[model samples]
Target: MSWSLKIFNKFPINLSSSIHARAFNSKAIGILGVPFDKGAGTRGTDKGPNALREAGLIDEIKHISSNIDVKDYGDVHYELMNTNGRKIHNLNDLSDVAACNKALADQVEKIIKDNRMPITLGGCHSIAIGSISGVLRTTTPDNLCILWVDAHLDLNTNTTSPTGNMHGMPASLLVKELRSNWPTIPELEWCKADLSLRNFCWIGLRSIDYYERIMMEQYGIKYFDMRDIDRMGIDKVTNAALKAINPNGDRQLHVSFDIDSLDPLFANSTGTPAGAGLTLRECLFLMEEVHRSGTLSSMDLVEVNPLVGDVRDVTNTLNSAKAIVCAAIGSNRSGNSS
Candidate 1:
């Protein structure tokens, strides 16, 4: 089962063509794949990056426009941490998670230094610990805002998390508000708590843990769950989210997009499938809006495990992921100017 990429000629969301014309750039994009999945309990998410690539993702992105410069930086590499007799309670594979994220952070920064927008393909949501950290290195938390699109708040600490999967705890690792929640884990010393929770906003959160909800309330974090979308609608909801996080519209924007944000009907291959998630068009519109912002610094598209479902399921998930990437890179449904 294979998939084809197509941009509709009549996209209903008219954010204005002038904006797209001015916003569209010969943007140089660097593709970096973090194939490390130690942060997740699932075994196959590490193959996500290559799965999309093998499905003609890069070629399709290149076909978006002649001016679009896309470079494949290839996959990130890291040393596997040997935890000989060392273990962290309730934190699964801390050593490997730390080791891989450290390397990922380094590469993300390098991509930025080269003036290419970093487009990261992830092993899981935990890869965000590195992607977000790398973006933080170039700008201050005050000047950066992360728009996290997922089914979960991802705000749990090791002790608060029922499952020790580091994927569930990346947000806590990077947020300053949750700094007190974590105990000293020597393996993760390189990863710091830098970004504040206020700098983060979430979308498509329908499956939040108890502790995560408590933390969200305590921090007054702004989020638009599926219920909110069901009310205000995706367009208005997306605009509100942009205004909330980047009110001034000048901050560096980093979007951590988890495929599980989409309903299982569209993305059933992911390890975590939340029902009544965003539709494929809705997710595409969000990416389109992100591109229109022109402040998109980097993005992490994660959690499409090819090994989790049947052939058709894997193909659908990959195609959805590829379409989102294309839209982010300036492929308009109204068609590109070039």
Candidate 2:
């Protein structure tokens, strides 16, 4: 929180090498990485975890506070299950998605049991299936609420997805109400649809599939799109979303943040870039406010594909990602006293 830290936020380089750790709200953060990207069409999104680390994410997060305890549990590893070359219709890499997410769920459950807030880095947005599943293992579905921040609904099922990407279908897979919508997948038997759409709220949505929009209306899902943010302002919209999902502020909160929620102008390194998305400042405020609520128990920062752009684009996107993670964990605008 020193001047150097604030400056580092604006200019990542040019900081004094000897800068010291600052005081911050106490947190025991458990970090996990998912290096599998078969859920999406992009090949490089699997490198998202390492890309953030190489950019000094751990060091910067450590620098945020002397009181914060940071532990990296390393990357999640899973082999693609044998499918005998018989692929499900409109569902790509179903076995691999099942394999990776099941392992991810087990590891995440362990982290939560150890009394640490699990922070997962993503290979793609599909990783949410495991991350949220892990949390549900320890916490009751009714006791937890989710804030899904993304430019897209990600609500398509195998029946509705145009691209056949598993990443676009995680939302549907995780919701209990939509269980009937999915056919029996022997591979994904490990994942149960326990969480309801009623406990979930979405923000920053811009591009939504036709069926997804209809489904939202049909289910009466709570959400705020870009136009809502534009009309109501981010602060009001965020507060409304929070109140709608976690009214009385008694429920534990989980945030699933997709990098594509950010505008392409700022985070073009992501696989799916939506124009006119949330600005960097708005994104920071949303995360920081969630932290301030003292109810945030877990989060997923996903969809950062390093191979999608040039070096500068990757750098900016990673910086934005680090900022989002830090803010969610209680980083603030005020600098540590020098």
Candidate 3:
């Protein structure tokens, strides 16, 4: 890498522009908005990326430092047709969902090629299959670690899902061979499906179906449930998650934080809210921990729906979102900088 493109390069910010498409002027942070919500069986989450951006996240990121280049790539475009004629267990209009995810993967791959950290603002948790696949394609398979922070296990496949929601499938797809289930979906096979299950970890989980639980145990994916959190404390649990996700591996880290991981009171806007979830402070501490780890190569802050809540819900979501981003790029000399 050239000295000018080094991670510490200094860059000025222009408040008004899409941050992902333009050539990064410094150690650029690329922002791509995935606005499709059919994955979640909800209408409002489609507005997530725009709402977060309109909440002045760019300005907040810029406020952190002048050396960081933040670029917005705008939202993924997908035409939503009727749900008629879709496969029985499939939630989304499968064809449309596949097309949209392909676009998402392509954009993410481009951002990674630009040598910038892709900070994706998501419409739903399902976008992970695309974004993570893109990153995993560019990065070595053996060096990939995914940190999934959510209240729900999200391990349901089409065969196990009662609601047939694709949002519940990303975690499983990330760790399993999803192409067999969605055989006709070309996008699901964008990368080789022979990836291992050893590099995944889940935190803040309070909800899990029986089938999902069995899968977690079967794969031996390290998960810190709510009870575990109460017993071990956030500091210890967070460290455990970090250690499990990386596992002495050479791969970089990618964190997928579903805002629904926050308590229902704090994240009422999301479609599926678990009874008890992480508090605002715990979530922030988790983000701070990720920042301190110094291995976070990309991040996705997802599932913020402004349409379902009052100003307070919106305010909490906005504040939580900002706090999480700050945690990811926190100042030096804080926490564990390992």
Better of 1 and 2 by lDDT: 2
Q: Which stretches of candidate 3 lie over 4 Å from their true place?
A: 1-27, 78-88, 177-187, 331-338
Ranking by TM-score: 1, 2, 3
The per-residue C-alpha lDDT of model 2 at residue 287 equals 88
Q: Assess every candidate by TM-score.
A: 0.92, 0.91, 0.84
lDDT of each: 0.84, 0.85, 0.73
**Candidate 2 accuracy as lDDT:** 0.85
Q: Cα RMSD (Å) per model?
A: 6.8, 9.2, 10.1
* Candidate with the greatest lDDT versus the true structure: 2
lDDT of 3 by residue, 220-285 (tens): 556777777776678777766666556443458888999988887767788788877888788887
| Model 3 lDDT at residue 286 | 82
State which candidate has the highest TM-score: 1
lDDT of 2 by residue, 21-138 (tens): 2222238889999997999987888999999999988888887788788999999998777767766789888888888999999999999888888999998999999999998999
lDDT by residue (149-178, candidate 1, tens digit) is 999988889899989999998888998888
- Compute the lDDT for candidate 1: 0.84
The true-versus-predicted C-alpha distance at residue 336 of model 3, in Å, is 16
In model 3, how large is the Cα lDDT of residue 218? 59
